[model samples]
Target: MKIGLVCPYSLGTPGGVQNHVRDLAEALLARGHQVSVLAPVDDNEAPPYVVSAGHAVGVPYNGSVARVTFGPRTAARVRSWLADGAFDVVHVHEPMTPSASIIALWAGDGPFVATFHTWQVRSRAMSAAAGLLRPALEKLDARIAVSENARSMMVQHIGGEAVVIPNGLYTKRFAGRIRPDWQGSDGTISFLGRMDEPRKGLGVLLSAVPRLVAERPGLKVLVAGTGQADDVRRSLPSSCRDNVLFLGEIDDAARADMLTGSDVYVAPHLGGESFGIVLLEAMAAGAPVLASDLAAFRQVLDGGRLGELFEPGNATALADQALRLLGSIDERDKLRATGLSAVLRYDWDALIDEILAVYDLVAR
Candidate 1:
């Protein structure tokens, strides 16, 4: 099968949708199918399978910055790619957003599928524009949501029932990449997300860190993602400043190693999480999980069966949960063992057939 995957964001940046598209394309290629990715390119080098449509400009949307390509030149490039690619099926991530995905959805004549990734907070602008966007959305041969919360949001805003197909993770990639140098001696709590992004609740984690480090001596907090590290450090209390290590941005291998070596992986997002891919990655890497009690996080954590959950944005609650988990080695081992077993469901091997089934249904 010749598959074309369209992404709205810049492939250069670390983002959920961009990562999903890249991994999905790789999984397809590994399964003896031809796969090509159409997306915006910034500083990153484009791989052979990637077709760069245009450069993306960062725009604030849904609580974080989305690097998106728009305007006439990009639209023309997208049209050209669609006409020349001759794909069997085009899968567009965030299909409604103004980028290569939407352009491909509008200009392409062949079968297409849209996977909605957002569980949007109520927005008057989205409500008002739904009528205008409905026709283009309905044109999708099949619609998918990464979680039930995302499916509900689509129904509320766009009036449609979408099939639920959760995101896939490369479990094997994370299972064994343990860098000895990256592992710290103390119990480490790792947070992997944009520190400046409010929805990710990095501030909440920062608030919890002071108490966490004081109670458990030699405790280290690893902040591993894109953000202004200096700003984060200066804002921290003087006493616990040395306890936090801001690894500004890390590559995939380092990220996997961090999760593998850490005692606990904390996802402190307040809301707006459609699915928990990072949480799944941590689970696959043998990190005991600690997440906010959001609906989407609950869906991925299976009501805290695999790991632990705390009230979102409450520093005291987060600190208490982290401290408790850090104190007992047995409890931590149990969580890690349970999470590792549960996360195998998300491995690409288990999910590729389901995605291919969707392609078959739409392409026929």
Candidate 2:
């Protein structure tokens, strides 16, 4: 089937939704389906469009603070695609913000299948926009959520039963050789995500790092993502500077390599992490996992059966857990073994097939 993916967020960029759309598009294409992604191009990747800036936490990146922009010209491009009706189905990810997907809702003349990936937590403007968009989303033939948290949010707003279809990863990307640069001092753990949101808990993670390294002198941290790296840089003590490396906005391949090389992966997101896609990538990369104490994360981790667990924001607790985790080489290997086993269920082919199944049911 020809699928037109409509996401307003800037892709070709470093982000969860962008990666999800790109991976799914690639997977669907491999399966002999025609797929086109409609998102503003933010980074130096294939497709070129607007640079939808992002939100700022405590520091500014580049020359600007952070904002996502979609002007009239991009809308013209999207409208042209919609009018062409070149797709058999329309796939919309993140049904809120940037206005492109909202416009597509009206412009596209095909069966629509959408996935809501976030829980309902946002600015009043975003929330209000979502309230307006929910009715239109309900009109879509197929609706799926990446997590149960997302499902409840969709139900609360859209008044429809939404299937839970978790986001997927290309297992091969994470299974490859470790990158040379990613190798840390003695033993290193890493965290990957946008650090601007308090939900990411970079603060919580940083707070834990000093404590962990205090006990385990060899412990190092590598943070790779597209947020305000400065805040983290400033907050980290002078002693921990050498141990913490900040790589701003890496592509999927480099991220996978980093994951493969790391001894452990940490995602101490305190709140608003509806689905931890990074955890899947880490697991796919054969790294043992550590993450937030959220139900969604637990569900993603299969109840700590696949990875280690820690308190959300308590640095001391996280540090103790990280140290305890590092000491358990056998335990980490077992967790890695378990993660590798469970990651099979998240293959892109299977996930795309399941999404198509949802479309079939919805269209019926």
Candidate 3:
């Protein structure tokens, strides 16, 4: 079957939806289905079977910057791409968002499947505009949500029933990757995500550094991903400064290595997380996880059975939990083992069948 996976976000940037689309395309191709990814491309090269509609510009949305193309030219280009692509099924991620996905859904022939990936506390005027948006949304023959949280948001605001299909993982890449050089003795605690993003709670994580190092002088904090280092440093107290190392924007290999080497992986996101993809990545990487008590994190951690949880935005709680988990090697190892076993259910090879079934059902 020929499948066209449409991602509304910029393919050039690193984002959860963009990454999921790319990985899903590859998995579909490996399963012998012809797949093409359609999205706005910037500096990043278009991988095999990827079709770029145009470039994208970042616009603030849902407490984050969304790189999406939403203009007459983009719409025209997307319509042309859809007309020529001749795909049997078009699986669009975030179809309601203003981008190629919306344009394609409006212009392209049906058997359309839309996947919802976000949920926030506030509705952002979308609920009020539902009457105007209903026609466009009705084009979707099937709808999917990455988690129960995402499905609930769609039902409350947009009035739709969507099947929940959690994000898939490149399990072998994280599980079997070699540990990076940074993963040596003295113990490493790692955090991955944009430091300047308040929702990620990097500031809260940094606030715990002083207490963490005071408990274990040899422990090191590895802060990965991109953001303003100065802003992060200002959040850290003077005493904990020396122990924190900023690793700006690491590739997949480095991330896998860091997670494998780290004594603990911290996800301190405050809210608006529909699914815990990074937590699954850490689990797949064999890292003992420590996460905030968000509903999304709890769902991914199996109600705190797979890993430890701290109070959201509470630095003291984070430090205390980290110290307790770090002090016991046996406990960490047990958690890691449990995580590795549990994450297998999310492997792409297993999850793809469910997604393919969605496509087949929609097509029928």
Candidate 4:
């Protein structure tokens, strides 16, 4: 079967939707299905199967800046790609967003499927655009939501129901033996996300650092993602300044190494998380997960049975939980054992068949 995947976000930036599309394409290709991905890309170089829609501009959306593309040129490119590919099914992610996915829905006609991945308490943009978007949305043959939160958002904002399909991951890539250089000591903690984004909650974790370091002088925080490092360092108190190490931007291999080598992996996101993909990555890497008690995260952590959860936006609670987890070797080991077993269920090898079934249903 030939499949065309459309991603609304830029491929050059590291984002959950972009990662999902890339991994899904690779998974399908490995299964001997022909796959092509259409997305906005910043760089000239992309994967052999990726068709660049053009560069993207950052738009403030869902508590963070989303890089997306829109215009006549992008629409023309979308139409041309659809014409050339003539795929059996076209899957557009975040189709309501003002990007390539929506344009693809307008320009192409076939067995169309869309996957919604965002979950917000309320979206004024979605509410305002619902009337205008309904016709294009009606073209979809099937719809999928990455989590129940996402499905609820779609139902509330757009008045539609969708099948719930959680995101997929390549578990083996992160399950490898830890690299020596990336190994962490007793007081080491790791964080991954855009440091400048408040929703990622770097500040919440940073606020807890002084308390953590006071208790354990050897505490070291490893941060990986794109941001202004000097600005972030300046925000920290001088006493615990040297305790944090910023690994500006890292690739997949480095990300796995960083998570695998950490004593604890912290996800401090304040809100706007549909599914905690990074938490699963940490679990797959055998890291003891310590995250905020967001609904999506709570579900991913199995109501805190697999990993530990602290109150959201509470630095004191975060520090206290971190200290307790750091002190208990038995607790961490139990989490690791349970997480490794649970993460396999989300691996692409298992979830791909479910996605293919969706395609089969829509295409038939």
lDDT of 2 by residue, 85-178 (tens): 4677888776655546766775665588888887744355555766777666656887889999889877765568878899898787777576
Please give each candidate's TM-score: 0.96, 0.87, 0.96, 0.98
Model 1, 262: alpha-carbon shift in Å? 1.1
- RMSD values for the candidates in order, in angstroms, are 1.4, 4.2, 1.6, 1.2
The TM-score, computed over Cα atoms with residue i paired to residue i, of candidate 1 is 0.96
Sorted by TM-score, highest first, which candidate order results?
A: 4, 1, 3, 2
Highest-TM-score candidate: 4
Tell me which of candidates 1 and 4 scores higher on TM-score. Answer: 4
Residue 272 alpha-carbon offset, candidate 2, angstroms: 1.3
> Where is the poorest 10-residue window by lDDT in model 2?
55-64
Candidate 2: list runs displaced more than 4 Å: 47-75, 121-131, 179-181, 184-186, 227-231, 361-364
Q: Could you give candidate 4's per-residue lDDT for residues 138-212 as a string of tens digits? A: 999999999999999999888878999899899999955566555435467999999889999999999999999
Global lDDT of each model? Answer: 0.87, 0.73, 0.87, 0.92
Which regions of candidate 3 deviate over 4 angstroms?
122-124, 176-181
Q: Write the per-residue lDDT of candidate 1 for residues 1-364, one digit (tens) a residue.
A: 8898999999998888988888898889999998989899986687889988889998877878899998888889988888888889989999767778877866787698889998877678877776666767767888889999999888889886888989989897886555555555558889999887898999999988878877876787889988899988999999999888888899888888889988889999998889989999999999999999999999999999987999998989999988888888999999999999999999888888888999999883
lDDT of 4 at 221: 90
